[model samples]
Target: MRLRILSADERLQEAQGKTTMALFGPSGAGKTTLLKTLPTEETVCLDLEAGLKSVQDWRGDSLPIRRFADAVDIACLIGGANPAAQPDEHFSEAHHAHLRAQHPELAARLDAKRIVFVDSITDLTRQAMAWAKTRPEALSERTGKPDTRGAYGLLAREVIGLLKHLQHAPGRTVIFVGILEKVVDDMNRVSWQPQMEGGKAARELPGIVDQVLTLSLFRQDTDQDGAVSWQHDAEKGHARRLVCQSGNPWGLPAKDRSGKLALTEPADLGALLTKINQTLKG
Candidate 1:
């Protein structure tokens, strides 16, 4: 038997199966709410902040974390929920080992057209930091510094590495949900930006994801009678408008707001995903 090696061009051609998306917005921007509309089969959600449970009438199939070592251990690893323990208690190494042992199955499910959502990467970062804190030697250099560079770097590496690994799997969609934070402009003005609490991870995400979508709601000026006279664009013309972003991914900015993408009404997540998939196809 002869061994064949793929050239760089061939390798690049083989890397087209994965899609990475980042959903970022303010506290009530409906990020998680939008997720419920995605196709349910083979989809797994890793909720860190436990926000997914807040949906008033979300009736979808969900897999809960019981033991740390199930076939879907990544759910627990990235979900950011403590495994039935108090703040002082720690998740044991046995749990990690169990997860490692079953990683192959988890990877397989993801490769089988399964969608995984990590709700709020912030909590995962916190869990990683807490785990790192237990190992002083691994994070000794950052003992007193509030920068959290060392800790966050280690955390980012792990999370990004895992994401990359999942990306390589045959037919998986990995959706990462992140919180919005206020970033101070050079003029000391504050603007809402995707919250990347894990310092290095926050800085590194733009380069990792294929697309980063920021969701926000803007209040329009109203008349003295409190009637909304006109709706305003969330961001002035300089930046891309979500409603009118290139290709109208959400079908939101048509000539008249009568179609599926109408921005005047509440966001319809199913319609939004359909439009996004259509945009991706185009």
Candidate 2:
């Protein structure tokens, strides 16, 4: 195929497109609950964590969830090229056929959805790691010592493939849910980031997504009756909110490509999407 140059109109149109969001926060910070507010009818959520207990109250017909039995199930969806028939590749026709037969809904949603949500990318990473261990190349026949180092690379490739797949889906948005972990240095300085097993995936994931958000809570005490009250947003929203900043004081590594929003109070994806739309229009 010959390379063809695109017109100015085409280039501009592509530039105006929206990018996906990568949401990460601590458990009980309402990451899952906030995601529940999205319109389920137009969204597809992959519940790789099995029973999403926090979203138990969600009444939008069980939140249009698709369950993945294990890591290989997800690996099969993001195909690539591998003689081992790695989840990223379809080197074996039998492997692809088995995956399609088992996960038809997931296969259909791969590139044909408006909104795709993967509940907890951290879990996805874990699943990928598990699948990596099953690969023969990751094992040493001599000592039978598993190649833990090699598994990290496979895990990263799987996640990167998944992100790219969702990002290129026509007119669709992807939200990768992940837990935030607190790390302390030798000096006791603290920082928060996505909770992934492998250092490679956790370290480099922020650069792969359009936005990285951190959710937190704010507390205040009443003066009149000496009552304690809690409110998170400085401007508006609820008792909690999601924050996005490029190296803020809170020790979260976040970035926004549009540079339109600094924080999203109440930590709701629905509101974030609204702000994104408004900013794009402006």
* Superposed Cα deviation of residue 35, candidate 2 (Å): 2.3
How many clashes in each structure? 2, 4
Output the TM-score of candidate 2.
0.75
lDDT of each: 0.52, 0.65
Residue range 87-198, candidate 2, lDDT tens digits:
5453345665777788787677663445667777878787777777787767776877888777777777766755664565446676888888877899998667678878
Model 1 shows how many backbone clashes? 2
lDDT against true structure, model 2: 0.65
Cα lDDT of model 1 by residue, 1-282, tens digit: 446899876654443334556666667657777666766665667666767766646654444433212312464343222334344322224554445466766545544445667676666666666654455435456454344455566566666655554444444456677777766778986555556546666666656665555565545576989886334444542222234232443322122111333443344434554454554333
* CA lDDT, candidate 2, residue 178: 87
Estimate TM-scores for all models.
0.60, 0.75
* Over 4 Å off, model 1: 1-17, 63-113, 139-149, 185-188, 219-273, 276-282
